[model samples]
Target: MNEQETGERDPGSGERVHWSEDGAERSALWRSESGARPPGKLAVADDRMTADAAYKLACEGTALLWRGDYHGARQLLAALARRVDRKPPKEGATPEESFHLYRQARFRRARVLGMLLVPLQISHEGTHSAYSVPLRRAPEVAQACEEAYGPPGEELTLVSLRELQGVLGAHEWRRKGVPVEALGGDRVHPRHGVFSPVRGEYVGLVARAPLPPGEPGSLVAFDIGTGTGVLAAVLARRGVGRVVATDLGERAPACARENVRGLGVQDVVEVVSADLFPGTADLFPRTEAGADAARADLIVCNPPWLPAKATSVLEQAVYDPGSRMLRGFLDGLAGRLTPHGEGWLILSDLAEHLGLRSREELLGWIDGAGLCVAGRLDARPEHPRATDSSAPLHAARAAETTSLWRLAATG
Candidate 1:
């Protein structure tokens, strides 16, 4: 499942921020997707402020409210990033320690960069509301802001320029869409918060894996935690008759529904708002004679690979604390499968390399769940980060492999 998805409510939507300017006190809506609170201290900054001064203030926990040119604020953010990058954390004693240090550094960097803020204003027309930065040289961002935060409200908002840049980038991706080669070059348009399927090796594994013994039209498959519904759509295209794609939150399900519809797999893929599977009884109820509903002929799950707490909405797609989703899928897999059904667990070995998880533990979980591996397919990491030697955990990533474990219920 992917991580980036929009929420029902924008982050910091109802929060208010206060600051003083020219002997007047002012307040505005404080918006943050990371759920950042209003800065405890605020300072108005403009073209006159030096990048070094702004960086110093940001590091000291004072938010710089930009009253300068919009593009200059971006440049200033970039300069801040350059400064932050100057001091890289020392490598730790082990891969696990290195990973933690890397995460901590990243958290600090985002916080420092996020201290640069901008004011957003909404102007109303006869039947339309538009969002823009009330500063010189501001680009038109109404569409991007609308797509991310919903229709513009009357409240003026203060948003981190870093977050706004993310919004703008997501808007572009949604406009062009990410191409999925396994889907015969079709594109999957990811929403603001919904995780995108930029990694294709996993999807290709699904496309080429041997199907369970049944005609495509006769097989009923369940895609657990379907993020963009990309895998569900892929299953449909591969001939699965009924593909139930389920996700927990509001944004993912909605994003999946839209993508599947666009892919013309709406007939075969059913996007559902659910955790793991829809209510178990509804999906696997007893028949008239007390026989179980025909359990899913094929169950596919691509859960978040890392076992760690998510710091933000986007991280949820990458980190799964305690391997909760992974274990849950394994624990529930056997009960929901047909006698001859197959469950595909798509996962990466990066955790193993990082010493966060061990291979034996994963196998033990499967055995405990009454599942036995029937077959396995493996793919080398093709993502850029895997080979980027400069990456903090490059050793682990370079050695990572994604695998699809074909699991069957143990007798």
Candidate 2:
């Protein structure tokens, strides 16, 4: 895939960022995983730059190319964060309004903090990709950068320090992996730009949900939008013999496949790159007599909960724009299920609490899709943010309940 399709910015692409230093114009390949446009104004900063001055420049939309010690840069970033947090967005009258305002505030904060930039010097040597931060006291980030951005071409890349820190954190998470209780304590390693299965409530619900009537080794299951393949692996471990896990775009499929293989379920789970159902042809092909093969006995999906626009690649895991994935899953569910099959839609009521979507609308969609709710399994979120009053939309989050809706086709 090309850079645009894969969400990977080409360092050698036309998105070059230029700045002035020592009476010469210096330019480097600009990279942003969030797809943010390069800053229109540029300034060179070093150890002598104060946090206040830097914050002012950033607020005025000037990107700072750091030429200071790495630790000091981190300190300045933290200082800027403190300043940003000192002033909070004004709460709106309604829950939905408040949620939108909160998102706006976050966007502004990210934009300002993202202004702190760093230069990454890189080279490609046959099979080895060498990279480093060209600043004093900079940590060894070659492996992290390589893992997140892929092997670099022979170009100096300019990236935001905020994004680089995220890359480093994602690398660590990918290396150590997150422990999923539903997977018998096995871990799921998420790559950069892929959503991590840190929220275990949904996984637990899937692990405990009742499977369709069949022998453990005889059932076929489909996991839609399998982010890190955690749910797919859970189903495989639960003895659903044949599991087809489908995901869209580049990172998710690759990440899910890696996790599935690492968890030793590659033999049972097939990871495919498709929007949702994989058009059904991949799982069932035409036979000699042109007979239709049996559909999946179980189909599970955990789409993004919020019906709002996502500003970055990471937010796609949290925001669902217009509930497109949810509605699409429901609309196509019945046609892809066996007569006695169950479609488990794992979702949260946070949107309802935030007034972004109504519970009535959800049920209506289910009915309109020629399906009915057979049963439902509910779990309260155990994530710390659920109880953190300081978090955005705390009231909505505190009352959130994640449910696994067991659905079946209506005759």
Candidate 3:
């Protein structure tokens, strides 16, 4: 029999009913109080409600008070997902349109499913309540929280159910690894806060482009802002004798090192921690070693594509805010290059399509830096987001193209 049928009424209704004093029973009471409920509707007693039933009810604007085991609710939510995915696709839609619709639908579905993850708060009495969510995978969550948020306190600790799921997903991605054919049947596992080279179109361009006429393996390339070290690995595989991968993030230094080691390129690739160019002090030679510091025969950089502020450190790989990294790299290009050395800047024109920046402005920057575009190679992004029209910037994405700008120092 369900908990409600034995003479229970809505607690808020203040009707007298049997109240269990046991800690287990009290825990159930706590969940009912803190569980998600649809706005402006009275929650009635129901014990047999499954997570799927609850999700469906919530989607249809109904609320479920979970009286089952906490872990059981998670399983129920998973079942609900199967039902949603089983539904047929919408009719009369093009592939591009369908792709966009799928992303939107998936996003909405996740948001709804996420609501079912109610937090369980542990109290000092060896009992738990639902006033707030206790950290999941508490040790790791606590560490990440400490890094992102300050040390924990009695501030009613909270985190987005969605973001927690994202962390778990990222962990899985790191474990499984990302495949790179350019690395000769190898895969690179990028850690959290590091860039993942999922789309290979740009990397392919670099791998296939002819090196300046010289000894086939004579080139020494510097991969500036090397996040996951994918580009550096690609260059190494392409027969570059030496590669130096640089990044400023503490996490990135270790991440790049791991990736470099994983792809078996550690012998020729050195991952260094630095902002912009390394081994160059103050842009002028202060010492003889600094003066003759190894100049790159082929310098490559894949700067953050968009011109916007990063919301978090993790977003730094995707957002360049003020085009600072791109501009800085361009301004420093002349000094860092060997005679006749070419700088390959892999970039996207999504900003222009989004009305955020103009192509002329970009060209102006290149010219102002005393560098001239020697030649350019172009490719289309193959990320699923490109074809997702329902995305906020779909119109801009449809018109975007990625390019490898071959630049030569004019000064």
Q: What is the lDDT of candidate 3?
A: 0.66
* Per-prediction tally of clashes: 6, 0, 0
**Any runs in candidate 3 off by more than 4 Å, and if so which?**
1-158, 280-294
lDDT of 1 by residue, 1-411 (tens): 011111133465576777678776677888989887777788889988899998998898888889988888989999999998888668446989988888888898999999998999998888888999899988889998988888888989999999999999988988999999999999999888888999999999999999999798988899999998899999999999888889987878888998999999999898888778655445544312454433688999999999998877878889999999999999989988888899999999999998999999999999999999999999998899898988778899999999999999997
lDDT for model 1: 0.88
Model 3 / residue 177 / CA error / Å: 0.6
What lDDT tens digits, residue by residue, belong to model 2 across residues 296-372? Answer: 88999999999998888888989998999999999989877877889999999999999989999999999999999
Error of 2 at 394 (Å): 0.9
| lDDT of each candidate versus the true structure | 0.88, 0.88, 0.66
Candidate 3 per-residue lDDT, tens place, 1-411, comes to 222212234566422223222322322221111122222221222336655556656475333333345445556666667666665667776444554565567655654554443333323334422233443323234433332233444323222244444555556667788888677658888766666888788788888777765664777788999988999988888888888889996878888898888888899888888888877544323323636555788889999987875544566887788999999999988778878788999998877776667899999999999899999999998888789975545656777799999999998
Q: Rank the candidates by lDDT, best first.
A: 2, 1, 3
TM-score per candidate, chains pooled: 0.94, 0.94, 0.65
